[model samples]
Target: MTRLVAANRVISTDGKEIKPGVVELDGERVVNVSALLGERPFTEWLGGTINLQYYADEQLCAYKDGKML
Candidate 1:
C-alpha cells in the first residue's frame, strides 16, 4: 500500500534540514517527494528507519521515528 508522510522538515543524508515536504512510500521504497519536482524512486534512502518532524499551524508539531515517518 502507498502511504503519505506529512513532515515540516526532512533530514537529508548530510544531516541538513531540507524543506517541508511530503514523502510517499510504497512499502520500503520512496516513490515520491514533494520538495523535489518529480516522481522517482529513492532506493538508497529506503529500508531504514526515517526520522521526521511534523508541523501544525506553522509550528513544530511532533517527531517520529519509523519506516513511514
Candidate 2:
C-alpha cells in the first residue's frame, strides 16, 4: 500500500530542505519526495514507522585480525 509523510521541511537532492514537503512511501521504502504543491490533499496515515531496519556495515573499512586481509 502507499502512504504519505508530511513535514515542515524535507531533504532534497541538492542537500537542501523543501518547505511543506510530502514524502510518498511504499511500505518501508521511500518512493517519492516533493514539495506540497497546489491543493492536493492526502488521505492516509500521517506519521508512523513501517518496518524499519538497522544493521552494521563494514564494506570498505572491514578489517580482519587488526589488518586488511
Candidate 3:
C-alpha cells in the first residue's frame, strides 16, 4: 500500500541533522519525497542516513531494509 510520511527530523549517517520532510512510500520503498515546511531538500538531506524515521500522519515510522518500522 502507499502511504505518506511526515518527518520531524532525521539524523544522517555523517551525524548531521536533516530537517522535516514528507516521504511517499509504496509499502517500504520510497516513491517520492519532499521537505516539509521550512526544510531543505529531502533527497539531499537524507543521503547518508541508514534509517529514515518519519511520521505517518500521527504515528512514528522508520524505514529500513525496504520496509516500514
Best by lDDT: 3
lDDT per residue (tens digit) for residues 1-69 in model 1? 776664556664446664655566665455555553334454233322245443344432223464233
What are the Cα lDDT values of the candidates?
Answer: 0.47, 0.46, 0.51
For residues 39-64, write the lDDT of model 3, one tens digit per residue. Answer: 43332333323345545564434464
Candidate whose TM-score is highest: 2
- Tens-place lDDT digits, model 2, residues 1-69: 776766555544344766666666565445666666744556342332222122244222211133221
Quote the lDDT for 52 in model 2: 18
What is the TM-score of each predicted model, taking all chains together? 0.43, 0.52, 0.43
Model 3 spans with C-alpha error above 4 angstroms: 11-17, 38-69
Report the Cα lDDT for candidate 1: 0.47
Model 3 residue 27 CA deviation (Å) reads: 1.3
Clashing pairs in 1: none
Hey, what RMSD does candidate 3 come out at?
10.0
